[model samples]
Target: MAEEDTARHRARMQRKKAVIEERIARASLERGVFLLHTGSGKGKSSAAFGVLARALGHGMNAVVVQFVKSRSDTGEEAFFRRHPAVRWYVMGEGFTWETQDPARDAAAARAAWETARAALTDPGVALVILDELTYAFKYHWLDLEEALAVFRARPFHQHLIVTGRAAPAALVEAADTVTEMGLVKHAFQAGVKAMPGIEW
Candidate 1:
């Protein structure tokens, strides 16, 4: 009975491998992708940063425009900014609750969007990461239509990664790959404080 079960498992694995290979052969599309990471999860920005690291590994020129984070002391920021190929901009005054002024937030978002626009249009930039950009759109700090237009007009070979929760429907529709990170549990809920390297 054990031998029979092993044979069956081997056959199942072979079938799965064949199916995967067929799909790989069928997929021939190759171009820069627009990726959106959304939903109520902690890894949205972290996942985007992983892609940034991959792009840099390939010697690609990249730009990161942070929309709603004021601090520049994060580990990823410090490390990526040291690379000559990256142009990093942290444009937000702070989080919404901390700023406590809608007008001020709007102005900051606008400024960040301007920088993002330039990055998107630059043909030399291979990758662009707009970190925490959903908050700007969710709060109506930036014009959605204007942002979409800029995205549509971006260079064909320029890849974009937009990360944050509550991504807009239009943005989702525009993205070639959309990943929604669902949260099942969190350390914060367990009263665990965020540690430096892990949280940052």
Candidate 2:
């Protein structure tokens, strides 16, 4: 009868809807891997921090290791440290240009890299952010090959985010997601000093 036909049509529609939902779920999965954000622009670190916030918001475990920037004078550092989902490690050494000592800078870079390596190996760490890592590699303080090996050896579900200016070509090739931010304008070009909370 007409009533029986209506019931069967509803059942069929429900099955179709279930199938569509399954497909969507499968496609939206995040395949954990390495992501490199680099360029001569101003937002590389900001973009990395955005990923950090997103990971923390989702109840995922994250570790942030700061390389060239270790001055604990930034608001982001203070805020993120208070978050329960994040483990923050700072090298406490400013930078190569600031220190003007290659040996000291190399030692600091190595210490930070050690922390980064440990985070990559930890199964509980879902996200690892290496802030300004490119500069360390550029300065030849961190071994490029060793760093790439760590990226390759991370847990199956672990993701990494490396941010800085002029990312090495080797890193760009290895990253699953590579973003290059081109510099259109910068206040530093006009002899204006870096502003607090904005550039720090």
The digit string of per-residue lDDT tens for model 2 on 1-200 reads 59999999999999999999999988876668788999887898899899889888899999999988868878788899999889988883785667888888889889999999999999999999999899888989888998898899899899899999888899999999899999899999999999988987
Q: Tell me the whole-model lDDT of each prediction, alpha carbons only.
A: 0.93, 0.89
Query: Candidate 1, which ten residues in sequence have the lowest lDDT sum?
Result: 143-152
Candidate 1 runs further than 4 Å off? none
Q: State the local distance difference test value for candidate 2.
A: 0.89
Residue 59 displacement in candidate 2 (angstroms): 0.5
Report residue 58 deviation for candidate 1 (angstroms). Answer: 0.8
Q: Which stretches of candidate 2 lie over 4 Å from their true place?
A: 1-30
TM-score leader: 1
CA RMSD of each candidate after superposition: 1.4, 7.4
